[model samples]
Target: MQQQRLPLALFLSLFGFACAGTARADAGSARLPDWRVSGFGTIGVAHAGEREADYTSSVMKANGTGATRSWSTDVDSRLGVQLDTTLARRWSAVLQVVSEQGLDNSYRPRIVWANVKYQATPELALRAGRIALPVFLIADYRKVGYAYPWLRPPVEGYNVMPVTSSDGVDATWRWSAGPVRNASQVFYGHSAVPLVDSLHLYARHGVGASNTSDWGALSVRVNVLRADITSNIGQDLFDAFDAFGPAGQALTARYAMDHKRMTLVNVGASYDPGTWFVMAEANRAISHSFLGATRSGYVSAGWRWNTLTPYVTWARVQAVGATLDPGLPTAALPPALAPMATALNAGLNSLLMRIPQQTSFAAGLRWDLRTNMALKVQVDRVTPHDGSTGTFINPTPRFVSERTSHVASVALDFVY
Candidate 1:
């Protein structure tokens, strides 16, 4: 993998040349050198109109923009950088990276957050290498698209659980309850990603808990997680249903994907109050292999008008358990293995149609143009149910699964 990212890019270029030689030896010192550096970016383009699938905003992307062409910048370009250091009295540290377009489509740069913290007092704090997986509610700035006003983040509620970061350890606490203010957290981690074809997705042990609260302009959040995942991305259709003996080993033990057991739950809320704003969230997921259950949500609203804002959103995802099953029957099979048991029950119900039902509606506009820039435009209008093909991607074969797609986007965000 590019020589393991060259030692995290030479340790972030030797910590940015030792924070630029401690700010040129504290140039006329007035105190301000404990280290800091920041960045964020996006320059995007998108278009889709269902050209037979391919409009992705993560499924760990492998292709995007209707039929993979017409228009796309891989759905959203990206760039990031960060650093924060203090490393002493109560310690502190962080490191970011980013550089988008992955799942082997390359734009490399990884390592999102390097972590190290400890401020064990005034309301606790603690961390360890690589963290961030709050599971939702802008999950730690959701890739900083100029700090949100949409052009993303509603892939049916952030694509269910696209997991972002995890290595191990976390702790947080913060207080105040009178006029509300809180920040609970707890974690333990493990993760591995890489999807699409060569597949990989592991999430071991991973534990979680989250909470957030505020009162002034209202805010709320809640989260829970569990893990013990594993993947083989359809090992040859569960080894052709384990060669059909005990009902093909009982359909590869009721839907393969090995070490299963996944669970997630989330809740969110927002309500700005400066001009206007609103947000909502919901989630649910359970697994018994083939990623069985699901339920997603989204809601957004905006209106600011000074530097433009205008927004709207409503999303959905639904597939609450079992999207088809019933394999290995082939009528008393024996007629020469009955066409290989009806082609392994039609390739395991066509891989359970990838379990995603959909609905989307969006509208956007954001202009902020300064103070770290922003500019956006959006449109969505998905729609896929029953014959699901929602999170589109590489369909073709005249792919028309309950057609209804329309995507449009434009972006230019920045931060520093």
Candidate 2:
């Protein structure tokens, strides 16, 4: 629909200001640029019980069971490297790259972040370039398996929005008062992601804000974001729809994804005292087009005993209607075209079912093998909503009934 592009002038202005300000602020400091390199990875194996469909982590992946007919390492395996350099006392830069299974089934390296940061003061900072989209509580570290207690974030909520990185600028403010720390961030950016079957998503204009509060072992966070979305319905399909003339045009106007706005809201709370922890997050994603709306959340609890921690989690996602009318206006059309209209309506209904609606239960254990490495084993039982396939992709024809999938995974996560 609507394509929004970031202007090169905006990036140039931000970059120039940071470099000039840093040079002036650090004129007296003799410290040279400091560089640090670190890496993180996960080696994992996964199997899904469903034989008719592939249970995937996100829309970007084509891994899992079904036609693969074998355990998939691509489901939970990735390697990432990060480099951070201090250009001056008040300015720094970070670049992070990750290699993982991608939409094309290749282990291509993707630039997740490459941003220059300027510390305006002790409590205020500004950054511009490619930055991670903080759409959820753990958005910054979602790829770093070692950062979270679970082997992976619950797909029910995390998989709703697949765009990972945004090209734009953001400002963060941090302060502390009476043992309580608070941080607020505001960002504006644009991103694009490719999905299954030649589906491409373009997010042009986006703006969001998040607030986090930390009080000892207790923490809370809330975030809200809105973005304009544009996606292609495939060239062949478009041609066919166009052939139907005015009726097809009307259908496209109602269903084609172009220039629709999507909104996301998330809230989370966690309590951790080293020995035991409980965390919960809730999210709602809505789009004005056929992407429809979904509500999802997860609750997890874990207790640590020395180097070993066991956790249990429950998660669920549900569809909240596609905002489509149940009755089609086929009666107003010519009798000869009525049948075609009915068929088109049926296809539209089938497309709307793509929205995920499922529930999952998981139990896992994390063993800290070393200071920066951990071993994890997790199992999940997922039940798709009646007659719905949930997040699984490439469903076998006629296998449209409700079904359950059991997944087992083991991973070694390391960070340095």
Candidate 3:
């Protein structure tokens, strides 16, 4: 793994973020009721209209029915808990925990966020420790709204670069820009991402920054991020496609390539004018997309008619194979693959190209039953652009998929 650490000196200077004003002060500050706790959870079920359409996590493959139908159910359901306690006159501590279907069906607990702070002032925060990245303006609260008309955020764009947290120091500065409140962030840090068997990400170095503008119920944000890949991150996936051969030289041109840098720049906007709302996000990555240079965008609109809200959303994503070593499998099969390679190629050809592309048309409904709870239902038509007529090529019948599947998802969300 590639290893790089900033001098402990920067740590000394960044620790103990000092804020300007004290959230807890006077009798209110020292009151015994100084601590507050809240929690939220979701229980939901969804069915894909395809027998071979499996659920979204790795766990579904191992534990679920593992069938062409009713395969797995881990999508919109999640749980979270947060606690805030005042530490001193103007300092405090916050901790949050979340459990959800993540990274391949491994139900893991992510600290989500745990930090100590000195509120030197409300307008500015000098926070250190492990801080969450402020990628999208709503990225922080993307999960809290079962009240959201959509069963989930548009995945075509949001799913491209979904990183949870970073280990580093961050500065959150909030001020006013005319009628809007503005928040900006700058962060430098080391991210410890689990290997998950990918050779390239066995370890990684992450750096990113974002800016947000909030005017009334509308907010807009843009972010830029770059990651330096120093090790063999995800060679196995290539191996799956027969990219690597007995000769390791097939992997990289340089004995060691310079840190592979992945950069992302995204712009997102959302507006809620009471009874009406509109949201759109567009992101384009350069030399760092899933296949590199992937382009994705989503647009959604909703209207509240009393307690019920109806919405529609559209999204598209495309990734072409450009960065990979063309000499590998898709380009030429190694001798070891021989007959199996021939069979694999034949089967893959029958299934069409695997260049990643997705277009979705979704319709959703939301009902607010109470002040703290809401019910949401969404149905989406997801079309995979690989041109494979159906899921699971006849050869790999085990890998079943529906060429087109209607996904119906429903969930209950609440915070108390």
Candidate 4:
């Protein structure tokens, strides 16, 4: 497995103490400490109908099904463990570790949350260290399958940007007025995320805020964030560009990925009253880099009848091209440099074209097997726009333009 050895021991120590509490409970039920340990996981199988490309939940993953394709366990299966306990009268900590398919296509455990929290009063609190980014409605608990009504979150919306956590400090304030309860959170942090095999992204000087309000069965949220972004483009491509002299320099300057600013905004609302529920959310991620701009959203509704619940979802991600020019003039360049200019323009267009433009419709049924477990089956029809591949990776020449792919998945989700 591709393990991040650093900080593994620190996370293990926190989990280790939680395990000791369990051991004490086994030895003497009354002697157990306040430490609590819990976990959630999904055993899933997925298949795709298209053979020219592989379908995946995230762009970071390298594995999926295609021509050599069949059912695979790597698509949605995952396991996570969390430890929560009090350190002092007003101080507490949380540690969470997860093992799932990642950028390296391995199940190695990674620390998801390792933070200390201090409660100053009933209405205010502070936290520091690695913490979840409140970038979406379910940002903090997106991995916990039992917490949501669907088999999985709409990939088009959730996969827009894969970095989920930041390393720094955050604070929350709570208040209530009449029948409405509200909480506001503000945070500042930095992060590094490995995307695919060649793109390693870094976010610096990041700051964000999230506000949520609840009234009866209705809940609403708004979030905004900004950060300075940088990424390591493929080394081979970098060298090729570097060799092209001023032309390459101009191309790199137009992209301006290093230290460029990125902004994200989100709005979401949901209403649930026991028997039925409806939800909708929208997000915009804009940047000056090659990552470009993405606008995504999803709407879902479900009706619960006894132990069975059926749901439907519609989601899509639309790519917005950048406004900057590549400095490749068609008529002004010399004869010797015409070929280079053409190549640069073509490369720029290819990068812009790769941004996803996909729409998907999904239907699923969830069966409550027990208090903490559920069985689910889902089917999705995904259609790409303008010859884009949507969420599919490793595209081949056989991939048909504007073709729709059908994907089916079955999963058992449980928590304890």
Which candidate number maximizes TM-score? Answer: 2
lDDT tens digits, residues 1-416, model 3?
12112222233233333222332244345444257898887777777665543533122122222243373456666888888776455566666677776544565655666665555687767656556766654567665655356777776776556555566667778888689898888887656544344523421456778988888998899998777755543333334443444532433332232365767788999999889999998888655322346678899999999988899999987755442332335335456665554554453343223223668889998898888888888887877664432211111343432366677888788889
2 or 4, which is superior by TM-score? 2
TM-score pick, better of 1 and 4: 4
Weakest ten-residue segment in model 4 by summed lDDT: 1-10
TM-score sort, best first:
2, 4, 3, 1
In the predicted model 1, the residue pairs found to clash are none
Expressed as tens digits, the lDDT of each residue in 65-115 for candidate 2 is: 654665888888999999988778778888788888887788877777878
- Per-model TM-score versus the true fold: 0.34, 0.90, 0.77, 0.88
Clashes of each: 0, 3, 28, 0
**Clash pairs (backbone) in predicted model 4:** none
- Please state the error at residue 63 of candidate 4 in Å: 2.0
Q: lDDT by residue for model 4 over 2-90, one digit each (tens)?
A: 22443344445544654554565466544433688999999988998888888877676767765446787888889999998765445
RMSD of each: 18.7, 3.4, 6.1, 4.5
Worst 10 residues of 1 by lDDT: 2-11
lDDT, candidates in the order shown? 0.82, 0.82, 0.60, 0.80
Question: Model 2: number of clashes?
Answer: 3
TM-score computed on alpha carbons, candidate 4: 0.88
Off by over 4 Å in 4: 1-33, 195-199, 235-239, 242-247, 323-344
- Give Cα distance to truth, residue 30, candidate 2, Å: 5.3
